[model samples]
Target: MPALLIDRPTCPATQLHSARRLIAEERLHTLFQPIVSLDCGVIYGHEALVRGPAGSPLEMPDALFAAGRAEGLSMELEIRCALQAMKDWSQLQRPGKLLINMSAAALSQATADGRWQRGLGICEDYGLQPTELMIELTEHERVADIDALRRGLTLLRRLGVGVALDDFGDGRSSLRLWSEIQPNLVKIDKYFTRELPAHAEKLQTFRALLQLAETFGAQLVAEGIEQPEELRVLRDLGVSYGQGWLLGHPSSSGASEAAPAALQVLASKEIAVMPELRRAGGSGITAEKLMMPAPAISDQASHEQLYRFFTEHEDQHAVAVINAAQQPVALIDRAQFISRWAKPFFMDLYGRRPCTLYANPSPLIVDADTGIEALTRVLTSADQRYLREGFIISRQGRYLGLGTGEQLVRSVTEARIEAARHANPLTFLPGNIPLSQHIGRLLSSGREFVAAYADLNQFKPFNDQYGYWRGDEMIRLVARVIGAHCDSQRDFVGHVGGDDFVMLFQSDDWEQRCEQIVGRFNELARNLFDAEALEAGGIMAEDREGNLRFHPCTTLSIGAVRVAPGRLHRAEDVASAAAAAKRQAKHGALAVYVMAA
Candidate 1:
């Protein structure tokens, strides 16, 4: 290993050097990488990154940091870079933190006399509040005098400023530093993040570190998350904040908002955790592809006015009867309205009874957040009983829009036809072919995602004892359980034959959905098994060797693989990895095992 050398120069000499460079040329520039809130999906702050100017060979951060050390002005350079970063990115001055990288040696030097006072003055000149600024300490650098370091940190804290341990876990002193420093934030280094999906042990270590950070009352921010899959995995591991190229690349302009191109990149990077319907390049039809936006009606008139409007907008098959506030009150089908108009004599004797074709508000509804898969479920429900014309969607008892049975049927039919080409006959679901296609799209999209491989624990034994009929029922029950957990039309729950099922969860509510599936499946499974067999806690089955044996009963073991962005290149790799994680969960006696890190 190469020796780690940190050089120092007198503050005045370094200041002159930096000032001359600024006057002669633009030696310094800055980039802002967002540090986002995991819970709310909001930009909580930005970590200001410094780089040398375009023409300089020290254009990269590693090269610049090394050059500063070689020039024997590491601390001065660091300080100058941080100050420049603040000035360049000042537009990001929101109700959020601004992280500026600081060398431990510079801080130590500043605290030696009353250097903090001068530094604080400079901060004031830059229009930054102590509370808004965070000093990010490079973890590898040694803080020689613990008392001095503690004093400086304490004083900064007193001024209502925060400190963070940067590149945390990259060196030996991280654990010790945690006890001594007690910073407000701990940024897990990218080294650990890179191995998350493939290395189980490292993932556990990362999780433990996060938990340790939480115990110390520090927020955990995982850095170097460059892949869609990696983001999903870290999110599942309960990381509170993250920054990476996949989320958004750094920009020196201090622009806080994500641009359209950036948003497109974020959206396209599909991890298995994202809903399946969102994945691209499958050539398969889905509800998302078929569904049209709800037609908006502005004019609010009485029933007569609505009748006339429907007549004018005859091309519209179905229209929502919205009130003045734009709340959907009822659905008016073109056929029903025209039919009623044709038979006015029928309404004259019946007093508008025959013409009044109003769908009940309870069953005919959909929310904006409702996914296509969940919408499909509502459409499929026998108990809900959708009308021939359409269903009315409302929120807070206010009408929002309308969904037609014909539209839904058309969507399902197209999907069903496409699914049939690659479906397993036994389960009547899209098989490995379609599953692989979807997974490939997910991997290619480069978004944070989760791929869950759900399998029935001790299922073979149950099948052996109860025979195929009960086994089929179990499979159907599992399908229903998986289906019930799906919310978005993009979210996919597919039967992969037998007891194995697959689901892709995107968005933030995946964990909750998993819990729901587990709870509901357990409740449903208990009644499916014979009371005696269930009580015995063992079921007889034939193993791979073909000999009959009694196997211990167990719950479903779902292997959830969180795909970090840019971490994975293929869907098959993810599937295999998830299967492996499932086996790990089974061994550890866990009902659900998330692939570590």
Candidate 2:
């Protein structure tokens, strides 16, 4: 949908002709996009992506494919690209999986003694195991003959090659197809994952799809997860596999050295203490180290003790009744203590004889080894709502003091808040606070870096027309697109607010990332607008002359600058230079201008 001219001649016809020449010349290349394991957070494998000549007219791979299809040379170009990708990938084959793109039409297109079989045999000749290969089928293309497609897929599967249904939900395929040709994996379309956290419907749809994937015995991958919230939610939903710009971008070699700074999750000391607690059975001690004092119910002991415990320990909603053996047998409440215990019935029955209603009817017990996750669920259950009043705590058969639900939640909430502040809210990037420290740390250790500044073109006018609610959503969407492009590289991105953002990357791949973000943002944003607005060329609105005028839609402009040690002393200086260059780029259509300095 987005057009990019990588190395087009001055003339349009000549440009098309050049693309044909490049393909026929077999000057195309390939790149690898790493797909990491979500569980252990390690690089599991890489997806092989096609690329054209260094200065070819087809700059972007998607644009190249579109051109190839239009020229009726899709299969030829695809085969050449796949072979090149495999050859490029073979040089760096680690103990990782290799994913290759396969067009259904290409595979189903009678190619027995043809190039397709020859390519497979070549892979075998190279000693690449079929099990190590994963063929990803395109969802946009029509499967002219389902039976033929199935037969080819079956043949590949029998050879131990894995089959993945790419962009599963973006197409019109049904549950019937899922039941019939169950894929080894389903890559959820980025369209669904991009705005999942903010959009409840998308989140629910993803959850349901995850269930469907699990039901069909297929591994589910939540693709296009570019935001921290989206990633966190997907992890919580138990989607076992994932791939997207957020996880990692497609690279030429597929080997990545580090996780992107924004994605680097900081493990808390308290989290480390969890395993130690488990090993020791449980955290037997609370903040107050002293044994929990029992609530005195004696007629002489005033309600002051009960009130103090309740107010002081916000965590303990329910008080426990301690027996002479120092073990808690029953739990009590302040209300029960006042209405039932302090009643004249106890004094009337006898300051000497035993009273019946002083103790609660039903009490709940918990062991020391009980985990926080299970404990939270148990306390929240209807049957155990009363247990939140106070639950009996025990360790190795020895009774400990009473604990309540209030304490645990407060602790967990505080920990989560501390963890979330590591990134900026607007751009969802590592903020100035974190970025400065990271830069200082890297600089102090003598690491080289490059800084880039990105800004949106005509965003204010678009926001004015769309209203702030949708405007905020647009900003968020663009942030995700930018963040997605960064992937898991050792990069730093931050929001200077509004339609502006910044990134610090080590490699020269910043331009490629900028191009991808701008292209994808325009495509997706156009789709988000109404059909009438899209048909109007541009939305009509009041101009400065008080007449209806159509304002141009928004686009992005990015500026990149090198951050060599002596050249750039501070991050802000580099950012300032980039911002100026970005202003120059805004005068054109989504361009990346490099700072001469």
Candidate 3:
């Protein structure tokens, strides 16, 4: 075959003119690529990439900036780029920070030309505060004046604009600049991320960088991540933020709204592996465990192609339609698409057209790390169309796969039923089985925690005089009070049957939280009795030996045991300590006794 013909600008002058015209007319466009949080499976921010007009000589970012630099218009070009990026970002209304690139030279020039204020004005016009924007110094040029740069950055910081040092570890001066500026974020260059898993020395260097970031309290973002192995290494090393082709690419119109696929892959791996490593108890299940490989059709697929797909795979209830970058743009319901095709002349009229022309443009997109309970709630509250069409599961906003409503409902139901089997009947809280498992998992993970055992004092007499139904109501009320006072994110509350309960607090504020629970329970306990009993502060009831006596109202006694890592090897050890503390607490009404060292 003959060589393929390609078009190119014939002269250097023409390309320069194009670059100049691009600046004069303000025709530069901004594209945004997502920066994702690997652990959470969410988009943390987006880095804006500037591109010239399609098919233009300055279309590529490096060429665009280099052309302007050669023409002595680098400062002007960068200012215009920032303005355009801010305006478009405001219009797009994305949730995270908008990271705009600026070279160190441009920063000095903008401050000199009074152009930085105009940039701030543009931000104000779009209802964006400085806090929402991050100015990333590309660090391609040496700092001409360290004092001047520091003064400019200080001003930006005062206005709530965060500074990020980009291309870290690329030069000898990178560390010096980092110390001088003390930026809030640092982006590691792609060289270290490339083939990271195969290079042990590179891993060690990355680990050192991570430690450096920690010392300065700056977040480290690994850039140019393109492979699964690279992502795995980054995640294992505890890298906080990441960006690259493996996550999502830049889009001219705006940032690609789809989640990153790497997040789903990492989450799936965690769901499959982490539980096994800590399965001394029942493992906490995530949505990824229930997720099946998403059935997907390309966004460019013809109507006939979709029809054939549905015909061949009769079991497929729905399929995600994805763009060229593997980002899901729409979802097609199998039955609905087939029903339309079943109409007379449907194939002849639209068979050759793209499937996207007829697919549902909006589908429910969920992160793979979403819990089963949370997933169930989202699906139940969704529109009927989405429920019928199924939903797309993403990692950080990139498409991973599709999940059917049937699968979600079934998984949630099974999880709920299994939980119900181990739930306390009175308070409907997790019973002894789950409580033991929760403590076991925490111990296995080597986490320092406080385990408190709560028991009701004078409860036998209160139950005898107040009937079992009333006593059950009191137990439920106590459960609610404890739950209200505990940190839901870091604490576990369980009912160990009868009037006994267990609390596992992982937060440093566990002491204050436990005190609050004790105080609140005492205040609410009086309300459970009648007016006479409330005034007297006790109810007359028969003792175990058949003697009549005045019994105080039911009071809570908490026995707390602080379990340090390596101190206790099993849940039962912690339980024994807490039980001993409980014995001490029962001597007084609404008392809390911390176990002695």
Candidate 4:
């Protein structure tokens, strides 16, 4: 207000004049948009937006900033906007913290000769602490010196001011910048967060971004989330913060709370659906998911450094040694290295040598993309050294992380248990829930399979005469016969309660297998009956109409339904079709009946 304006422009560009006047007179408008915490559903901070006078051509942020930038007033204009936003924020006592954008050019230049104090002086004049401010790096311009920018950001962080990288995945967002600056927060671009539920590619990309954020120890702030689905996804994906119209629109009066719609989404108790685990080339359960982020060292590092690292950090059980190409070539167990180094004068003699001399060059190495199920099977055949040395997981031949045999074993057991949790207590086979899930997966994958229903003929009459003791044995015999005949890898056998079983076959020899089961079962079940009943060739049991009749020997019957891809979509539909085929088989004379559904 005291006329600290820059020199007037020579050209008659009204836009330049408008930009200067707004900065000089302190008449620039500022709106505040809330960046809410996705976890707590509470306001985390407000991003300050600077605009020109209402209804003016320069009122838009792009035009207004362009005008200032053209006249070489970028730094001066940014400081003025910061002051305006800060002054308003303090007056209104906004909740949480305040975020203001600083162009890369301004931020890097300010660190050259301590010009950053000018921005600090503005904060001091407004009676606000640096802790209440967050500097967002705008990507509108490239930094002349990134080192200077990093220094400036470090100074701000030391002074209790947080730093953020804005609109990540666009513009200046790069791995170099991310590693060098080490920002406290990263605001994701709109492209990944908008209508996230409808875009599969975006969903997977966002998941990888979340992992990257975790690796860098930075919190994620999803920008431009306008839909309810987008908010839920970000929240479920473990994003820390979010901003969009759905959360709260930009307002002249700072919004101090969450929007009603966002509150509703946060109120949901149901867990969000996760992205599919089974990606192409691997089952969803990969070694990467189970691998511990165990740190790796270069093979060129000295043995003394490795020893000291292990001594200082006791949690690491082993250290991997990678070559110049970042490929893991060896593993050093802490126990083994420490034992060897503890010998008298061992460190003095060998500590100066490369650590690779003490490492196992042939450690178990597994590709990160390999399915954990396959890894489990491989480990089952591995020598005892696998348990001692653990394993290395990599992707594209580059080291990713380290995994132990214990971790792999535990994960596979848990996955198997979780898959068939609803299993039959008697036979320990999958029950109805797992049966449906398997059928559903096969249908979803468009795989052609044979759905077979297995039932014992004259089972009820046998149970009534032989009592529950023999009856259970009869059922067990049927389960054993069916299980032994089917190919375990290509077939799924489930018990659908008492004398009823479901078998989903992917093998080409399913019909022969079914017939074998029937033939083998008929021979085994005859042993359960008494000699008198066998000699008489029948038993006197009440028929369905309540009259006594002769019942023949108990035999095995199987009803088979051939399912083609695209013919059935639902699990219930397939089950019903298979059941109808079984009923048809029951009225026939053949031991194994086949039909299509």
Candidate 5:
């Protein structure tokens, strides 16, 4: 039947006619790709991609949409694509939601043209409720009327139809659009997902965007994930949904479930060794680290566009207008714009004028790479205006995102909590939390490691005799010794607590390092003690029984456990096994025990 359609068009002149005939003849077909839940390993939904008849000139979506746009029939063409997908998806009897793509222009036009009503009718015809469908906004065409688009989407969402923004963080995707539309899900661009394990900047971007998603009460769908490593990283980032060839390929047969191998990857307990933020030259955290989703627009845009943008994005406190060079030109406060816009004759006089008429051309605009510390010291940075009306965040004079005093303070506060988890205060080494976290990364990466548990012996009695201040000095001595012996590049040394430390050794000479650590700690142990305790060979202190007794001087006991790949499922399990080995080492004469786990 498809063969009866016109042969692939060879001339540009025939493209429009071919598109019209393609729609008239109902030549479009739908392909479904399963979007799977990263956390639960279930099929979340299927995105329906429309294609023209096989071997036709319009077989590819980009060509087909281009033809439609060129012919001024995009609204008709998009409706046909969506309605056919709905018809085919209903026939496939697939569970979960069915997602269809629509250009913002077409969506806005559909509101008054009744084409959307026809789509709703198609859903009902298939016994599918409005809730079963999701309209994903594609960036194929620019949106000319922001208010119309918002109203159209609002109507659909009101009727239980889900809304999403496709290829987010790509092309002209605006944070203002994100804030204004409040999509149920945002499909992250493939650029960020590709080779994600090697890109720390991408990881940090996703982390910030994830926080933005949470703030808006929406989920993120990482798209174009073609590697198991990418999928693992997305899972670690707590992304809700994922769509890519790694999970399932788009097929005409409409495979609604993930493939067996992909399912296995999802079900695995492996944690991704997520790329960590590395600062060059010990640079402090930059302004980029604290960025949330704030949208920017071109200065050439009209005031009506700005007005509609503010009306749609009530949650957004501010919007930045950038020049053609992508440098920020002005900042628009939501309240200020709306208040001025509400005045009598304001819309009648300036609705169509350039938005810069009302914009603050001298508003705060900071480079994205500006250090967070420098930002806090700026005059009036502590003022309430920036908290309510955010400033532009740019990189090399080009807009990157937005920031505010409120989020800056919040980010610093949150970072302190993370800093505490990453390192212990007294010892200033990696803390217990990072100890387990690194173990998990090693186990997931299939790397062999030695888990060395170090404990200070008779430390309570020593503390009782010398007091906490002296005990702290003793603990510091142990930390210094342990840190000095291990290869900082390949091994992790963590101060779990007072007198207790953990080392995950990836070095080949781990055993030698352990022995050196024990010898070094014992050598330094005497210096923390007074002459009287040193002369007595041990200190007089109460034991666990609370009886006054002569206790041995503080000495370090080292327990080493060799952990091979796949020997443990959980990092905590490895930790427990190592701790068990430590107890055995404490009883041994050598004060160091090495055993396979």
Candidate 6:
């Protein structure tokens, strides 16, 4: 047998002295761990984690912070760590938000003495705006004054700073604090994320927290995601942002690298999943994800200057020309510029002139919000010259980056293929596979909305009398009516199969919208029958029991379920509730029933 091992605790004096020396000498350092956006597969931000002196007793973060708290130096240590982290981050000048950890005690103290302003001042000195820095409140210690903390956070917000609640679901009062503070972001604790794919309870808990965050208008970040399985599960659950060792590890240097190979593969797989999740309507991919950062030249730059830039960067296919307002005016293709300059007597004619003379007058430009499919349509319709020149991606009419026609084509093809596999053939609406995923996504997003399930009452008899073709027309007609009533940008309308359909209403006036759909559907459905059937108000057909009978014209019955985040956790639960409501609606002719909360 191995020898027995016993651990000894450090003395109070020793711990206190270590903490004091660490603060006095400023031996603390910060390591940056990248937080990635699951939706776009890019680095959303970098969270700065504090580190103690190497080979010292307080090298670990828990030991350092705990020691500081024991020795009454928590506030001092916290401020010094934040200052050092910001200073290090400033040196790298990386784009995206910088997340800094702060304790409740430290925050309360900083607000009291106006030290928080000094922190913001340091940030400004480093050329960072308040909006770019996110102060993450760690739950190491209980807050003494909740009201004072809120006041401090409100003041910070006024300065354009973003606040985040860290390690949520680990502390007893986290839920209460979230309700009172309404932070801009919430990070779920590692306990919930670790081995999440295997634990049903953990997954359910995470789903609940996701809903809670959505209800508060706060974005959720999953922490300590070390496994690809965990990442996949989170992505499927519609978690928008996450940070984990699997994506990237902490680095002393400020360079936050791209996600690892495994994660890249997972990100690609996520794109395929997007079409299924968004089948009811939106594009899963946006221009922002496809854009590549290219050098932008001032419109006033001389041709000689532009030539030199192209010569130095052999890999550059195109460059953007921007005006004084930083709006893209034209895109200069490298080959065109080089060929023009290489012509005989070209230098003498225009070498000294501004590059704008050679710039394409009408460069292709697209907004970052443009969907990949829509962008493809624009590209395919454009002249061949524009396709070779590529297009500039912009946000709010300002130049962001450049995207090549090649990338757009590839993305569009993949999205189209994925969409075709899941689309319903009869009505061309998204099928049940996408419907279930969409419902789960909505619930995970934490927004309270309405889900309405529609079934055509007495559809079989009408189909029996009118033949399959007319039945198809009737189903298609109902789909058109539902689409007309829905806000295409906000609501999701899907065909579950046969005469059944589902709609997710996110608009504030969902009740009125559902009523409108019901009323319109009843009116439009009548047109599917002939004048004789309309006058008789019935179709002669064989009933399900094989008995001859006169069936009334088909009518629509809708069961609407109002979903509150915490109350309904799964898509299956929502479906069951909606089904129950639909049963009530079918009891009456041309009716809708919205289930109570």
Which window of 10 residues has the lowest lDDT sum in candidate 3?
Answer: 271-280
lDDT of 3 at 305: 97
Model 5: colliding residue pairs? 176-295, 368-394
**Highest TM-score among the candidates is held by which one?**
5
Clashes of each: 38, 5, 9, 1, 2, 0
Instruction: Predict model 5's lDDT versus the native.
Output: 0.81
Give the poorly placed runs of model 4, Cα more than 4 Å off: 1-5, 8-17, 111-115, 275-278, 282-597
Local accuracy of candidate 4 as per-residue lDDT tens digits, 370-443: 78668867656746576877889999999998988788777777766554445665676767776787788678
Screening candidate 2 with a backbone cut-off below 3 angstroms (N, C-alpha, C), the clashing residue pairs are 32-251, 33-250, 260-488, 315-407, 318-389
Point out where model 6 deviates above 4 Å: 1-17, 171-173, 270-597
- True-vs-predicted CA distance for residue 223, candidate 6, Å: 0.6
For candidate 5, the clash count comes to 2
Error of 2 at 362 (Å): 54
lDDT of each: 0.66, 0.62, 0.77, 0.80, 0.81, 0.79
Model 2 weakest lDDT span, ten residues long: 268-277
- Deviating ranges (above 4 Å) for candidate 5: 1-17, 280-593
Q: Give candidates' CA RMSD values in order.
A: 19.6, 20.6, 21.5, 17.7, 17.5, 21.0
Give the higher-lDDT candidate: 5 or 6: 5
